[model samples]
Target: MISHTAAITIYTKTGERREMAEATPYEEQRRRQVEANKRKLEELQLHHLSAAIREAAAAAKPSLVKKRKARVPLDVADAVMEPVRRSGRLANLPDKPVYREKVPDFGMKIRRTYGSVRRDLTNRVYATDDARSYAISKAEDLEQELDSSFPIFIKPMTQSHVTGGFWLGLPIHFCRKYLPKRDEMITLVDEDDDESDTLYLAMKRGLSAGWRGFAVQQKLVDGDCLVFQLIEQTKFKVYITRASSYYESED
Candidate 1:
């Protein structure tokens, strides 16, 4: 007796023809579920709803794109130049004048004035030989006692100093260092504790006006020497050394 059985044909890469059989029960169930989902979507019209949403989104999208602004040209007639700002590092102040020491030039001739006449002091004599020697020794002894701790200057009496103009010019360096820079009345204290007011001429750097009174009161002559010690501002302790000629003339 002959029996019939369901079987599938197979194919090989060697050019043999083949037939595939229907899927198994499990695979068939999965295929039916997929077909059921498709039918549900069709009934609900989900594809048409999605198409409408896409159309609405496209309509709502902004149509204008952002662009850079165009440059505007300026007319020459309307253009204006701005003033330059100065540097902040520069101080807003007047220029300071340079300070220089007033000094006489070299090889320049200096003339001493005695009232109306100009005199040459080159061959001038201060005192006799013995009198000058005594004054020098006394000054040396006094300087040794002070030891330069105080400011001191010596002025030998001249015709211009004791008579005529009666103007006494102190050493330039000493005036610059120890004296006032303006016209003022300075006190002169003698060895007897007597104080005399004398005028300090800042411009000429000399003593004027009242100096004649001090010279006359002290009996100062053309050969006497006076030592000025600055004891205070605008005050001097004056020490005098009279010449031998003065004593002779007095006798």
Candidate 2:
């Protein structure tokens, strides 16, 4: 025969009740089971998160392609003439009129003669200011008395006594008096216009005569009757021997 023990109950002045039974082994086992289930659920969630991360990485692949861009020459004539076109001063003048030409023999002869003649004629003519005034007066007198149709060349004397360096300052009216027709005015191709057609001929002549940088300075005039400086030095000299040939030429 087994007897079940009953717990004693005590009541204090305050009404409160307390459970006297301790936890059974079954209850403790149930609590441990609940905790274990929660742990397994957390592990499963971690596995799913890792799988999703791997799938996302596989979907995002890198590309291996490149992108490329295309490259044009310049017009030389247009570039060169553009500046001249923009300048208002050259607008009225015909572009073709500025064409280059070969220097004529007559023009070259004048330039070569000018330097030597000035030295010979005016070397001792002016010493003091009074003498220079007198010489100028004489030049004016000669200019006035000379025939209008005569070809005249005038140049300023250099302060230095160089042999062949005379300043060409002849007035244009003086040149026109002799060469009235515009067509009669001669032009020369020189070192300045080496690439032009006229220059090609000039170069051939210069080479045949063993010269370099030869040029012909020609006279020009305006409507105002002003004489232009008719002579200029060329980069090449034909030597006195070659110059003699030029002098003999009729043109």
Candidate 3:
């Protein structure tokens, strides 16, 4: 969690001049929930795997009672679930939620920030680091805008967006005006300031779930959703809301 003063430092460094902002309490609570959920999912997976192995051994004559997981191929664990993701396999395929964790809900509000035992997830992220670097080398403009902006609102994504999936493309601009270096950490924060904000770099490492990835996120209330707006090219805005905004199109 960031102190209010720290939040301001990030802003002033970027070029925001004394604009007061704070992330809401709701944002911080949800962010913590998501993190806790990810950690617990790993624990559950270990238990699930252990139970299965134990059951297999208990069989009177265990001869390949279980098809060896080797058939699943060897994989490195990542922070966000992929491969075995319980949901949203279509949009972010190949890379899927390794484990599907639960976003707990109670009635109309969140029963808890992050839920339990929905699925398992990997602790290590894959391939995304390279992807971010490639994206950054390709687009500099988007980086600058985001760097200067500091904390912008984000729409919490659903299982459909794919696990470990956040944003894609946008215009390129040199970021020296805001970020000291193109690859330097770019901070994204909520104007409300409850400390749910995250610092990220568009190109360098980009943003995703992993030790080196962005930790900032927004968790939705029971009915709310996040919308992705492509600011330019692949640089998009992940906006949060109760539901999608519907405006009549010009006939």
| Highest TM-score scorer | 1
lDDT tens readout by residue for model 3, 1-251: 85543243334666876744565787778889999998998978887898889888787565666675543333444434354556775656755345753322322332122222122235322223333333333233333445444422233333322234433222234332323343222232222332222223445433322111222234322223333333332233443433222111112
Q: Ten residues in a row with the worst lDDT in model 1?
A: 106-115
Per-residue error for 126 in candidate 1, Å, reads: 7.4
Going through the candidates in the order shown, the clash numbers are: 0, 14, 34
Question: Any idea how many clashes model 2 has?
Answer: 14
RMSD of each: 20.8, 19.3, 46.0
Return the TM-score for candidate 3, rounded to 2 decimals: 0.23
> Would you list the C-alpha lDDT of every candidate in the order shown?
0.72, 0.36, 0.38
For model 1, the stretches where C-alpha displacement exceeds 4 angstroms are 1-126, 245-251
Query: In model 3, which regions exceed 4 Å deviation?
Result: 1-164, 167-170, 174-177, 197-199, 202-205, 209-217, 220-243, 247-251
Q: For candidate 1, write residues 96-154 as lDDT tens digits.
A: 55574333333332222212343344645466666766665666566566637679988
State the lDDT at 118 in candidate 1.
Answer: 32
Give the 10-residue window scoring lowest on summed lDDT in candidate 2: 219-228
Better of 2 and 3 by lDDT: 3
